[model samples]
Target: MNPYEIKELSPTGVLAEMGVEQGDLLLSINGRSVVDELDIRFLGGEEEILVEIQKPDGEIWELEIEKESDEPLGLHCDGGTLGIRRCRNNCVFCFIDQMPPGMRDTLYIKDDDERLSFLQGNYVTLTNLSEALKRRIVDYHIMPINISIHTTDPELRCKMLGNRFAGSILEDLAFFSEHHIQMNGQIVMCPGYNDGEALKKTLEDVMAFYPWLQSLSVVPVGLSSYREGLPALYPVDAQKAAETLDIIREAQDKMLAQYGVRFVFPSDEFFLLAGQDLPGEDYYGDFSQLENGVGMMTDFKAGLRDALAGRTPKSKGSHRFGIITGVLAKGFMEACAGAIEKVYPGADIGVLPIKNNHFGPSITVSGLVTGGDIVAQIPKENEIETYFIPENMVRYGTEDFLDDMTLGALSQALGAEVAIVPVRGDALAEAVAQRLIGG
Candidate 1:
């Protein structure tokens, strides 16, 4: 059934000004039943439109609208029109494998849809791409797409994706490259599985595509609490982390020297795990992969410095606050908190590292830190007036965390006012400044 029944409509153009009112259901647009907003956007911009409207009283109305190229119909639709696509692959290191059940239903959904990849920058493995879907990507010209290309080796890629169809990633990449379609790639580095020589080979293979491939992100694999039957997956220890860093650093240096660009970046987790400082800001040219945890630390530190620069000290008594983060980011967060405190004296901004009891110790990225894990670590009786959660935890415009717990519920349980800091450096510093200024 069509999810939209426009109650009121005002399209004052060459066509008649007619209203559908509150009891009307939007059946079809230009003879096609709209499945999603994408359909509406795709179909509604034509020179003439035929809308099939259905009344709640079981009557159907055919309304035709003729407008110039620039006119828009004031239409309304249900927010839940878009359906979530579930993932099919059974990869052992999937963070979703570790999630504790019995939360919101949406939390359990494992999405691998390219539509989301195009719309929200979510990464999609090409394993699920049908020929028709591939054609649509080319037809729609979904440029600047993000893909999960953990490895390029056919056999290893098949093993990594746990699907036979996954082995053709190179072919898919070739298709995109041939079409001049820009894309960013992600590798969820599993320690024994794909880290050492495998990672190097994968980088070499993908970087071969050059400018067609925009950037590559190498993030440490996350393990949640729900992995009982999955294959063995281990976290990268300090030694392995250092070795990975060394190998990647050399590769990055060579890439910079040869291509005039650092084609690959290991996420902030690697630097923190290896006890190495983040790369200089200039190393992250344009920060295209920041959302994937690349250059995030550098961006955060720079943001804090600018936000607190030339700022006034706390007006009166102490106002304590805490920012929760994953274990890998503990040191960086502490240093930034200290810097902020230095600028504004008498403000105790503590950096609290929330251990991953939900996803296991292997997962150390901040984006996967659940509310339950955070609530478990942070003390209730602390003098801190408010707790800051990373905005990355929640879907934009929604209170739901990736794990399905609402931020409000977590805040209530913890007895603290929680504010989600925007994922950017500037927004994060501004969040701190606002709290300091009592805003």
Candidate 2:
């Protein structure tokens, strides 16, 4: 890896005061080579620092600065990322493997880099971790690294990830724990493979890590119908969901009695597929696994209630608004629509559940719903001036949908304004009030 050169500089940053310029190559901080963003962030946290920069004219410059420990160095790199380390393991349940050819190139890149885990909340299967990298992570106190430890049993993990070296998940967890590094974990439960007894063993083993393992999310293996010749994996059926839910519930009771926090949580899909009502907010402390869909409904509904408190949108135009969502979130979206509906009784509101034809029905999450499928499946009768679509349906931090279709194109095709609603209570409430109620 090359040294991270300064690609850009904040005009008001400490670096600017130190005469660092754009195109200056960042060589080191306090004799440590500046390789990635993590290095700069970790080393730059010191109260005293030596920054070495190589200018475009091939001149070396050294500058020393004394400042507050937590003060930023005020440098911006491309995405604040060092470099992406692509995933090497061909896991049995790898979602990327199930994707059909000829999609956006970004969708195909599988990243298992720990740097991304610390930066972007992306999970990494410790299979690619080097001893040097591990040391760096521990030394830097990279708190709360998201790890993908599908199973604890060494042999089973190896089989699951299809990499012989993948069996050291427990050892890796032990290392992180020993260094007092906090970690969250994920398990993509592939029904027959990791479910039943295997699931029990994994859970028990993971819980043994205690406060170090912070939390573990158990989500079902999502298999899109595009898998033509991939290995056959069973979807989490009602019985399977119930069985998994039972295990989690039993585990939760024990966890509550011990640590008072349910360390393990099943994804929302499991509860919905099992036809069981989701637990209350108390079951999900801090809502740590909202992205995992653990307490998403609870949090969203709770947020909606909070958003609807006190202020009523007195501006009453009978504006009909529709919410576009996936099958799983239809009910919650309806509830959101209802909140606005109560304000304007005759406001035409509709809930549109767009089936994911791009990845197929098995992929039922809104995030997987493509622009083409949504454009095709949207009911013509469900007409509304503005459609509130979950921001998850579009790419992260971009307007581009999964099918490479921009929100502008979708809006143009539908001839209606599409408002992107974020996956947060306050944002959703604000969007609705501002868009539909014109507040």
Candidate 3:
């Protein structure tokens, strides 16, 4: 069976009640073909739905279900598609191209599919958008499609994306705007290239569409060590990051005055690298550009602080814990550890900062920290009774790090039980409370 094949069902559950069993292929829901996981959610969000199943014996079975509109049919299918569409463009700053050999095959695959943007929150360039595909997107009424629009200058965009046809970013965005498509945009600002004047122009051009452009996130380009033979792109240094934030602040003030919202935001890395303080939580309304690392640390800290309010921290006995994070977020993590220790006056917590040895130091973010780096850095001298690592470091819904190192391997190397802590503040507090206070 293929990766997308339905391989199992929850015992004594919805699928079983409908006579659907393991090995049966999910053909469609409500008579629409199930192309990807997005199709499942879009089609299954109906009170009454018809589902078609293909049995192992080549027979088709049609079943009707009655349930709440948003209820799901319990079926364990493939987490990812085996035959997923690949990206067509070879953009100059493409991260995958900068990766050295000897990694998992999946890491090398570049995907620019729009369905992924709607389903998985992955950004799409819209370079592959055809008239027919555009109509399909509009017909489906996909909301807040995340797009990578480096710049509004079509010719420069073409040069950046390394495709002549890539220059049509604005043309496609205009189409989405005419359709009132809500979109979040990302700009990987390159020095001497898209920043400063070009950025100002791009922001103005995008703001012309008003609310249709939900938010635009300006992020500095990450320069990896493996960028041999690639374009000579310099890293966004302290001065450059500071300058970019200045540009963003000016534009942000103008946008907020005109639209009552900070229509543009720089990613957290900029403020951190520039040695400038991040904006307070209120600046990021609902954090529309959060996934792009814009205002993430601010939101996370605020959430954690709120979660910690009046929540008693208790130390049942003498306990020591190590919380692992990347070098950049070490300060924040140490502060969080201090807050946790406030409740448990007897408990000792150490914030373990791991340098990004796998990726270059420029790529200093907790989410990018590999399991090997943590294992290499977490010293036995810390006497860490237990280790706490962010859930994001591991793959989504799995205990595997980006460099293909599993949590089991990390635990074995560190000689300590690993606790995969949730990124959410409340969930983290609850988990810690259970582990430390209740223990």
Candidate 4:
């Protein structure tokens, strides 16, 4: 029996539902020990499964249940292969490099795993891909790979990824295109590195492989306080953002005209930096790459509006909540705060823009915000009963922020109850409603 073993009391014929329960530790399936989700997924569905289980309270349970074809076993687990694949490339624009020290170790550890890409929609650079793994992806028929193609220029890509193997993006992309692998692409535009004419060239190169290339997202390179000693990477200013947008808009038009699709879209950050309005939801055809910051703003607005309409339009009591956000989202926060106020009259809602002190003023995204930034930003003596913080700012099971401050310490320092709201727009109003009613 393996250390992590679980039994299948009710077999649904699906790999996940083969017998593991809520508190069971999966030991093995058939004769093979379960190493990771990838291995399990690689193992494929079994007609007859030999499952072993270990209960939480020092008990072992084993059961062999046979079921019908393609039945899904209902089970979920957080542990993946027992370790995350940490990143090897130390790119100058890497946001993890900009993190202030002392936060959760998980937050600091960078992952470039394809398993995470398939399971959680996290992006991966094809540079670290081994031949066996590449072959496995083809064999496994893993559709829609999320690739970080920072630049089509091999020399520039090598510089951006900080790995010699990084130059293989075009070759790898060629393989994916040849194999008919559906994939979405990303380009982290640094001011002088891959923007302007360089960006246009990259878009054209990628579009040549369109249709197989589902979508492309161009996001601005993020800077943080930890940027010392890194290559002289520059932030995208308003002028640069506008230029990038213009270039992408032109490419989108061409792609739409010839390919019958707008294959490229600038992220919300670009428009925000340019002080421009977010594109309507219709502009984001299908939103297949929403996780890559493409169509995220549009989706967020739609979700928020839908949630707002579902609201009862009445608050049970007077409640004041302060929503903390980074400078990039000031306009968004203000607009959202306004809507919430209208729904709940006397609902004193304030959008607190926290200067990125931990990552310096250059950092703008909420996910990179540290507890220290929030601690310094939140008004200590404000009459607000609860400080609403977006869940994006902190990692799971850790007190530290993107910089290094603990949530517990921040809560203590502020002398107010802290509520961590998820990034989902639909959940935001529900959380606010809960905080108001003391639920």
Instruction: Give each model's whole-structure lDDT.
Output: 0.78, 0.84, 0.82, 0.77
Give TM-scores for every candidate, taking all chains together and pairing residue i with residue i.
0.85, 0.94, 0.87, 0.83
Off by over 4 Å in 4: 1-36, 48-83, 310-317, 397-400, 403-409, 435-439
Can you write out model 3's per-residue Cα lDDT over 16-116, one digit (the tens) per residue? 78888887888888877776666677777788999889888988889988989767787767756545667888788999998767888988999998888
Error of 1 at 145 (Å): 1.8
Clashes of 1: 9
Q: Which candidate is the best by lDDT?
A: 2
lDDT of 4 at 326: 82
Q: For residues 1-439, what per-residue lDDT tens digits would candidate 4 score against the true structure?
A: 1354333334443444543465577776676666566545554255566666676876665666565535434444445326677788978688888766776576677899887888888889977778977987897678788999989998888887898778878888889889999888988998888888889989989988788888999988877768777788788999999999999999999998997899998988888888898999889989887766777778877887888885566777788788888888888988888887787775888888888877688877777777766777676888887777877777666555655567778888888877787776777777877766543
| Per-residue lDDT of 54 in model 3 | 87
How close to the true structure is residue 252 of candidate 1, measured as C-alpha lDDT?
Answer: 84
Task: Tell me the tens digit of each residue's lDDT in model 1 across 1-439.
Answer: 5456454455553322575665577778889776665556556777699988777778888887887656766665554655566687877677666767766666667999887887799999878778977876786577777999999989988897788878898999999999888999999999888889998898888887878898898988776657788888877778888988887887788788889998888888788788887888898999999988889889878776777677666644567888888777787778877777776676788888877777677667677788877777776877778888887777778887766679889888778788887866667666666766654
lDDT, model 2, position 352: 86
- Which of the numbered candidates is closest to the native, going by highest TM-score? 2
Worst 10 residues of 3 by lDDT: 1-10
Q: Report lDDT (Cα) of residue 184, candidate 4.
A: 89
lDDT of 4 at 119: 83
Candidate 1's error at 9, in angstroms?
Answer: 7.2
